[model samples]
Structures are given as structure tokens and as C-alpha cells.
Target: MRFIIQRDHLVQSVQDVMKAVTSRTTIPILTGIKIVATEEGVTLTGSDSDISIESFIPKEEDDKEIVEIKQPGAIVLQARFFSEMVKKLPSDFVEIEVQNHLQTVIRSGNSEFDLIGLDAEEYPQLPQIEEENVFRIPTDLLKAMIRQTSFAVSTSETRPILTGVNWKVENNELYCIATDSHRLALRKAKIEMETPANYNVVIPGKSLNELSKILADNNEQIEIVITENQVLFKAKHLLFFSRLLEGNYPDTSRLIPNESKTEIVLHTKEFLHAIDRASLLAREGKNNVVKFSTIGDGVLEISSNTPEVGKVVEELKGVSVDGEELKISFSAKYMMDALKAIEGNEIKILFTGAMRPFVIYPINDDSTLQLILPVRTY
Candidate 1:
């Protein structure tokens, strides 16, 4: 295989595909990236069994030649060395050629490198997903959904199911939920689909996080295809696939309380900042716990105490406190995460009781909800 390509386009594609390549794969060829040069364009693929990425660079786009393929062939080269070489090449263009016996050579302005390549036939094939069950979503909205929920996925591997985010689609609405038992983050958005279908799939948090990072903030729409065990995300010339985790995600609908004993409406920024400062002292404490207590008419007190580091007390003014006045303790980290995820300026906190899990969300938006389990503070 031989091809000459533009430097910037190749660099970007390499960086994206490299996200799926792992150095510790049991299959030796998985550490390399498969490059296929055809009459249409040059395709690069990277995979590690759980995830796979394919990037295509067309031979010519908009009358400008991006890739010129002299011979149609395929080769697999070490991702680590090849990506680094291409990025550091001291020119605006790169030329790659694969010779007999899987020997590959890359050349640029005043620099050239040779790498031992493997037969592309040994690389695992990417999962084939049918296009029947496909939908499109704006890139920005998809990224927002991922940011709002992926963080809440359980980091513990003991419950493999909890380490992934649950995605459910029905009636033109898409819902994403993630939980670590102590807290939950949920986001919903309206989407367009060609056919009506219901899908409940659990995708690894790690995979979603990577996908979010790769998706740009442009107004372009991304196509998503869901199959029995794999989900494919296609944006422009890039395609990403991830294997779905098998098992029934725990039913979390019942965990959200139906009633509240106390409710408070506060400015999002003010409350976030107060908790940020309070957490400093709480971090020095045993459990990083912060306490919130409602005072007379529209006043809320935020405090944290540590035996060795003393305590911090701050009053956030001009907040509406309704229902029974109550004090509750919760992880400062959890509260800050929930606050950052909210998009509105004002937020409402609903507490069923001092010990029950409290919910936080925007004042008017019911589509997104964050729940945090209170921490016991003696």
C-alpha cells in the first residue's frame, strides 16, 4: 500500500482512532492500526475488542487532493510509533508506502522512518451494524447528555452493570441515566428517528466519555445505530463502535422519592460557591460531609466541620426555604457535581427527610434530575 496524505487531516484521524488502541491487548495485532488504501479514500481502524474506531480520509475533497493512492492494499502498523511519527513530521504532507514482507516506510520533509508492519488480515474485524435502527442527534446535545451523566457511573467493577450508563429511547425521547448507588444523574432530550422503536442499552461510561471528547461542538448531526450488542456512532467521516454490557440494569425509577418534606430554591452559582468553600474544611474531615440547614424565611446556612481543622459556616442569602425547616448532611463532592451539571441559574433541592436521598434539579426543567444520598454525620 502506498499513499500520500495531508498532515493535519492524518494527525486528527490518527489521534481519534488511537483512542481505541490498547497496548495490553491479548491479541498482538490489536496494538496496531489497520490502514486500507482504496480507490475512494484511505481508511484507518483501531480496536481493542471492546471498542473500535474507523476514520476515513477521502482521496480528494472539494477539488483538493487529500489522499492519492498509488496502490490499493492494507497494512497494520504499531499505533504508538506511527501516530507519534506522523504528528512530529516536519512538513505539511506525509507519504507512506508498504513493501513486501510487511515493511512500511513513512517520509516527510527532511525526515523518514521505517516500521515493521503486520498483515491487516490478522486484525479483528469491526462489528457490522445494520442501519435500520438509526437516529440522529446534534453533536452538542449528545455531548451535554454524556457530560451530565457519565461522571455518575460507578467506578467499582464489582457490579459490572453499574459501571455503564443506561440509555433508553422511546416515543421520540432519549434518556440517559448513570448511578453509583450513592447518587444518580439523568438527562433527557428529544430526538428524531426514521422508525419508531424502543431501545434499552447499557454502554460503558469510559466509552461514552471518549465519544464525548471526540465529538466537536459544531452544529453537525451525529448518526447513531443500535444493534443487539453494539452501538455505532457516526459523525462525518468518523465511526465509533462499542460493545454493550450484558445484564439488566437495576430499576432506578423507584429510588426517586415522590414526596418532599423540605424544599429550597437557591441561586445555582451562590450555592455552588458556598459548597466549594465549605468542602475545603470538609475534605479535612473524615467523610467530606457538608451540612445544610434552613433558617428563617428564605435563608439557608451551609456549614462543615472537622475535629482537627475546625469548621466553616457560610450563609447564602435570598433563598426560598419551604416546607419544614430541616438540616441535612451530604458529600460535598456529590453536591458540587450535581450543581455543575445543572444548566439553569436557579436550582431546587427537594428533601424527603434528613436521612433520605434528596433530589436537585433546575427550577423549571424536569428533564434532568440529580439525586444524592445523604451522608450520616454523627
Candidate 2:
């Protein structure tokens, strides 16, 4: 395989595909990136079984030549070294040639490096996903949905299912939810579709996080195709594929309460800052617990106490608290996370009781909701 490509274009594609390459893979070939040069353009693929990312650079775009292919073939080069070499190449273009026995040479202006390449045939083939069930979503909207929920996924592998975010689509509506048993985040959006079909899929939170990072703030529509065990995300010139978890995600609809005893409307930033300050002291405590009390005269008291570090008390102004006045204790970290995920300036928090899980939502928006389980402070 031989190709001369623009340095900047190759660097961008390499970085995108590198997200799927894992250094800890048991297979030696998995540590390298597969490059294929064809008549159309050059394609770079990186995969680690669970996730695969492919980026394409056309030979000519907008009447400008981006890649010139001398021979049509494929080669796999070590990702770490190749990525660094491409980034530091001191020229506007890079020339790559693969000779007999998979020997590869990368050359720029005044420097050249030889890397032992593997046969691309050894790389595992990406699972083919038939476009039978396909849907489209705006890139920015998809990124928002991922951001609002992926953080709440459990990091522990004990319950493998909980490590992924649950994505459900029904009747032209998309819902994304994630929870670690202590806190839950849910986001809903209306989607445009022709035929309506219900889909319940669990995608690894880590994969979604990577996808969100790769999705730029553009108005382009992304095509999503789901098969029995794989999901494919197709952006302009990039394709991202992830393996679906095997177990059924637990039903979380019943976990959200229907009633509330106390409701408070407060500024998101105010509450977030209060929690941030309270966490300073709570961090010294056992479970990082902070107490929130609803007092008279539109005042919310934020306090935390540690046997060795004493206590802290702060009052946040500008909130309307109704129903029975209550005091509740919860993880400061959880509250801060929920507050950061909210998109509005004003937020409403609904508390069923002192011990029940409380829900947080934007004042006038029902499309997004966050729930946090209270922690007991003796």
C-alpha cells in the first residue's frame, strides 16, 4: 500500500479513530490501526472488539486533492507510534509506503521513519449492521442526550448492565436514562421518523461518552442503525460501532415517584454553588453527606458536619419552598452532578419525604429530570 496524504487531514482522522484503540488488548494486532488506500480515498480503522471507529478521507474534496493513492492495499501500524509521528511530522503532506513483508515507511519533509506493519487481514472484521432499523438525530441533540445521562451510569462492573445507559425510542420519542442506584438522569426528546417502532437498547456509557466527544456542534444529521447485538452511528465521514450489552436493563419507570410533599424552586447556579461549598466539609465526613433544610422566609440552609472536622452552615437566598418544611441528607457529589446536568437557570426540586428519593427538573421543562436517593445521617 502506498499513499501520500495531507498531514492535517491524516492527523484528524487518526485522532478520531484512535479513540477505539485500547492499549491493554490481548491481541497484538488490536494495538495497531488499519489503513486502507483505495481509488476513492484513504480509510483508517481502529477497534478493540467492544468498540470500533472508522474515518475516511476522500481522494479529492471540493476539487482539491487530499490523498493520492499509488497502490491499492492495506496495512496495520502501531497506533501509539503512528499517531505521534503524524502529529510531529514537519510538513504539509505525509507519504506512506508499504513494501514486502509488511514493512512500512512514513516520510515527511526532512524526516523518515520505518515501522513494522502487520497484515490488515489479521484485524477482526467489524460486525456488519444491516440498515433495517435506522433512525436519524441531530448531532448536537445526540450529544446533549449523552451528556445528560452518561455520567450517572455505574462505574462498577459488578452489575454489567448498570454500566451502560438505557436508550428507548417509542412513537417518535427518544428517551435516554442512566442510574447507579443512588442517582438517576433522564432526558427525553421528540424525534422525526417515518415508521414508529419501539427500541430498548443498552449502550455502554463509556462508548456514549466517546461518541459525544467526537460529535461536533454541527447541524448535520447522524444516521443510527441497530442490529441484534450492535449499534452503528454514522456521521459525515466517520462510522462508530459499539457492542450492545446482553442483559435486560432494569425497569426504572416505577422508580420515579408520582407525588411530592415539599417542592422548592431555586436557581440552579445558587444551589450548585451551595452544594460545592458544603462538599468541602462533607469531603472530610464518612460518606460525603450534606444536610439540606427548608426554613422560613425563602431560605435554604446548607450544612455538613464531620466529627473530626467540625461543621459548616450556609444559607442560600432566593427560593420558594412550599409544603411541609423538611430536612434531608444526601451525597453532596450526587446533588452537584444533578445540578450541573440541568440546562435551565431556575430548577424545581420535588421531595416526597425526608427519606424518599427527590426529583429535580427545570422549572418549566419536563423533558429532563434527575433523581437522587437521600442518605441517612444519624
Candidate 3:
């Protein structure tokens, strides 16, 4: 393959595709990126069995030439070295050529480097997913959904299913839920489709996190196609594929309480800051637990005490506090994480009891909910 391409465009594409390349792959070729030059454009692909990303640079866009192809060919180069070299190339354009025996030449400005390339034919083929069950979502919204929910996925491998985000689509609405048994995040958005579609799938949190970083924040619709075992996300000039986690995701609907014994409305920032300060001392404790209590009308006290460390006590006046008097203890880290993920100035928290899991969300928004299982400290 031989091509002279805009360095900036190539650098961006290489960085995006490298997210899927892993050095620990059992297949040796998986560690390198496959580069293919065609009359239409140049395509770069990287994969590590679980996830695959492909980036395409068109020969011409909007009547402007982005790539000048001298000869159409394909080769695979070490992903880590190639990506690093492209970023440091000191020129506006980069020229790449492939010669006999898979030898590759890279040049820009006054610098030139020769690299041994692997045959593209040895790379594993990405699954060709039929767009039979396809849906569309705006890129920006998809990124927001992933950011809001993926953080709560379990990091433990004891329950492999909890390490992923559970996605469900029904009644023209898409829902994403993640939980690590101690805390849960749920987000929902409405979607439009030509035909009625329903699905329940578990996608690895790591994959969603990587895909979010590659997507640009825009209103452009991203096409998604899901098969029994694989899911494909198609963006402008980019394609991402991930293998779905095998096994059924546990049913999380029943975990959310339908009623509450105590409810409080408070400013999100104020509550978040109070917890942050209290955690300063709580972090020294065994469980990093903070205590919350409703002292009087619309008055709440947050306190943390570690025998070895000093105690911290802060008072926060809520917008509204009603229902029975309550005192609950929970992990300061969990509360802070939930508060940051929720979007709104004012938040409403519903507590069923001192020991039951409590739900937090925006005051007027029902689309997003965060639940934390309170620590059993009275």
C-alpha cells in the first residue's frame, strides 16, 4: 500500500483504533493494526478478540483531497509503535509505502523509518453483522448514557455478569442499568424506529467506556446493529464491534423500591460537598461510612468519626424534608459517585428505612435514578 495522507487525520484515527489493540492477545497478529489502502480511501483496523474498531479515511471529502493513493495494497504494522510514530511525525503529511516481503516505509518531512509488516491475510476477520435488528441513537446522547451508567458496574469478577451494563429496549425507550450490588445507576431515553423492536443485552463496561471516548459530541445519529452474540456501532467513517457477555443479566427491576418511608429534597451540589468533607475523616475508617440524620424541620446533619482520625460534622438545610425521622449510614464514596452521575441542581432522595436501599434522582426527572444500599450502622 502506498499513500500520502494528512498527518492530523491519520493521528486521530490511529489513536481511536488503538483502544481495541491489546498486547496480551493469544493471536500474535492481533497486536498489530491492519492498514488497507483502496481507490476509495484508507482503512485502519485493530482488535483483541473481544472488541474491534475500524477507522476509514476517505480519499476526498467535501471536494477536498484527504488522501492521495499511489498504489492500492494492505499490510499490518505494530500498533503501539505505529501510533506513537504517527503522533510525533514532524510534517503536515505522511507518506507510507509497502514493498516486497511485507517491508513498509514511513516518511514525513526529513524523517524516514522502515518497519517490518505482517500479512493482513493472517488477521482475524471481524464478524459481519446483518443489520436485521438495527436502531439509531444520537452520538452525544449515547455518550452521556454510557458515562452516567458504566461507572456503577461491578469491578469484582465473582459475578461476571455484573461487570457489564444491562441494556434493554422496549416501548420505544432504551434503558441502561449498572450495579455492583452496593450501588446502582439507571438511565432511560426515548428512541424512534421504523419497526417495533425489543432487546435485552449485556455489554461490557470496558467496551462502552472505550467507545464513548472515540465518539464525537454531536447530534449525528449512530447506527447500532445487535445480533445474538455481537453488537455493532456505526459512526461516521468508524465502525465498532463488541462481543456481548454470555449469560443472563440479573433482573434489577425488583430492587428499586415503589414507596418510601423518608424523603428529602436538597441541592445536589450542597449535598455532594457536605459528603465530600465528611468523607475526609470517613476514609480513615474501615468502611468509609458517613452518617446522615434528620435532626429537625428541614435540617440534616452529616457526620463521620474514625477513632484514629478526627471527626467531621456538617449541617445542611434541605429544600424539603418529610416523613418519619431517620438516621442512616452509607459509604461516602458511593454517595459521592451517585451524586456526580446525577444531573440536576436539586435532587430528591427516597429512603424506605434505615437499612433498606435508598434511591436518589433529579427532583423532577424520572429518567435517571441512583440507588445505594445503606451500610448497616445505626
Candidate 4:
């Protein structure tokens, strides 16, 4: 392929696609990025079987020429070297040309480098997901949903299904839930679509995390399509594909409690900071556990103790306290994560009992909820 392209466009496209390329990939061609130049524009593709990302740079945008294609062709170049080289190129434009035997030359501003390229034909094709049952969501809301739930996914692969977030859409409502058995995050939103459809799929937390990072903080709508084994996210001039985890995600609905023994309304930031300070001592303990207790008269106490380390106790006055007073112990990290995910100044926490899982959510908002399974300390 022979093309002269703007340096800024080239760098951004390379970085976007590079998210899918992993050096640990077994496939030789997957280590490189496939570059194709056509009459329309230049397309860059990167994949590692599990995930694929494609970015397209138009030849001309807004009546300005971004790329001048001398000859339309395709080649694969090592991702690591090519990405690094493109960033350091000292010019506003970069010229790339391919000669016989897949040899490629890059030149920019008094500097030139030759790189051995791989045949683009050998690269694995990305999954062709039919665009049926597609739905759209605002980019910023999608990012928030991912942030609130993906963190709750299990890091251990013991129960592979827990490593992903469960996404369910039914009757124009989308619900996302993630849990690692110890803590759970749930968020729900209403969506409008031309044709109503229902779907339940498990998306890898890692994939959602990467996609969130790539998406800009905007209100632009992002098209999403889900198939039996693959999911596709389409944005302006970009396409992302992720392989679905095979297996039924456990039913999490039954885990949320219907009743509470104690309920407290407190400030989100106050609770979060208390847990952060208490965790400092809990971190030296075996399970990083923090103890929370409701002392009477709308007063709450947070404390942590480790025999080898010191103990800490802090008091927080709640806005409202009702039901029976109780003491519960839970992972400090889990509580902090739940607190940060919730959006609002004041939060309501519902405790079923000292041992059962407790739910936390923004006051006056039922759309988002966080549940934590209290640690048992005798």
C-alpha cells in the first residue's frame, strides 16, 4: 500500500486498534496490525481472537484531504514497532509504501525506516454479526454502566461466568449486573427501539473496561448488536467486536433481599471516606474486613482491628436511622467500591441482617443498587 497520511490521524487510529492486539497471541499474524488503503479511506484492524477493533480514517473529511493514496493496497506491520514509530515520526505527514515481497518503507521529515510486513490475507476475519435486534445507548451512560458493574466481576476464573457482566434487555429496559459472590452491582436503564427484542448475554468485564476507555465522554449514541457468540459495538468510524463467554450467567435476581432489618441514610462521601480510613488497619488483617455498627440515636460506628496492627473506630451521624440496631463486618474494598459506584450525595443502605447481604443505593433512586455479603467474624 502507498499512502501519505496526516500524522495526527494515523497516531490516533493506531492507538485505538492497538487495544485489541496482544503480544501473547499465539497466531503470528495477530501480532501485527492489518492496514488496508482503498478509494474511500484507510482502515486499520487489530485482533487477538477474543476481541477485534477496526478504525477507519477517511481520505477526505470536511472537504480537507487527510490521506493521498498513490496506490491502494494492504499489508500487515508489527504492531509494537509500527505504533512506536508512528508516534515518534517528526512531521505533520507520514508516507508509507510497500514494494515486492511485502517490504514496507515509512518516511517522514528527513527520516525513513524499512519494515518487513506480513501478508494481510493471512489475518483472521472478524466475526460477521448480523445487525438484527440492534439497540442504541448514549456513550456516556454506557460508560457509567460499565464503570458501576464491571468492577464487581470476579477476578478469579474458578467460576468463569462470574468473570463477566450479565446484560439483559427485555421490554425496552436494559439491566446490567455483576457480582463476584461477595459483592454485586446492578444498574437499569430504559431504551427505545423500533422493534422490541429480548436478549441475555454475558460480556467479559475486561472487554467492557477496554471499550469504556476507548469511548469518548459524549452523548452520541453507540449502536450495539449481540449474537449468539459475539457482540459488536459500532461508533462513528469505529467497530469493536468481543467474543461472548459461553455459559449461562447465574440468576442474580434471587440474591437481592426483599426485606431489611436495619436501614440507614448517610452521606456517600462520608461513608466512603470512613471505609477508606478504616481499611488502612483492615488491610493488615486476613480478609481486609471492616466492622460497621449502628449505635442508637442515628449514630453509626465504623471500626477495624488487626491483632498485629492497630484498631480504629470512627463515628458517623446518619441522616435517618430506623429498625433494629445491628453490627456487620464486610470487606473494606468491597464497601468502598460500592460507595464510589453510586451517584448521589446521600445514600440509603438496607441491611437484611448481620449475616445476610446488605444493599446500598442512592437515596430516592431505585435504578442503581449495590449489595455486599457481610464477612462473618466470630
Better of 2 and 4 by TM-score: 4
Judged by whole-model lDDT over C-alpha atoms, candidate 1 comes out at: 0.93
Instruction: Supply every candidate's count of residue pairs whose N, Cα or C atoms clash at under 3 angstroms.
Output: 0, 0, 0, 0
| lDDT of candidate 1 over 1-378, digit per residue (tens) | 898999999999999999999999999999999999999999999999998999999998999999988888999999999999898999999999998899999999999899999999888889978799789999999999999999999999999999999999999899999999999999999998999999999999999998988888887889999999999999989999999999999999999999999888889999999999999999976678999888886788899988888899998875678899888899999999999999999999899988899999898999999999998763
Candidate 4 deviant stretches above 4 angstroms: none
| Candidate 2 TM-score, true structure as reference | 0.98
How close to the true structure is residue 342 of candidate 1, measured as C-alpha lDDT? 91
Which lDDT values do the candidates have, in the order given?
0.93, 0.92, 0.95, 0.94
Model 3 stretches with alpha carbons more than 4 Å out: none
Please give, for residues 1-378, the per-residue lDDT of candidate 3 as tens digits. 899999999999999899999999899999999999999999999999999999999999999999999999999999989999999999999999999999999999999999999999998999988887778999999998999999999999999999999999999899999999999999999886767799999999999999999999999999988889999999999999999998999899999999998899999999999999999999988899999999997999999999887899999999999999999999999999999988899999999999999999898899999999999888
- Model 3 vs. true fold: TM: 0.99
Model 3 per-residue lDDT at 212: 98
lDDT (Cα, tens digit) per residue for candidate 2, span 1-378: 899999999999999999999999999999999999999999999999999999999999999999999999999999999999999999999999999999999999999999999989989998887777678899999998998999999999999999999999998889999999999999999876656778999999999998888777997899888777889999988999999998999999998999999989999998898899889988977689999997788888999988788888999875688888889999999999899999999999999988899999998999999999999773
Clashing pairs in 2: none
RMSD of 2: 1.0
Check candidate 4 and list the clashing pairs.
none
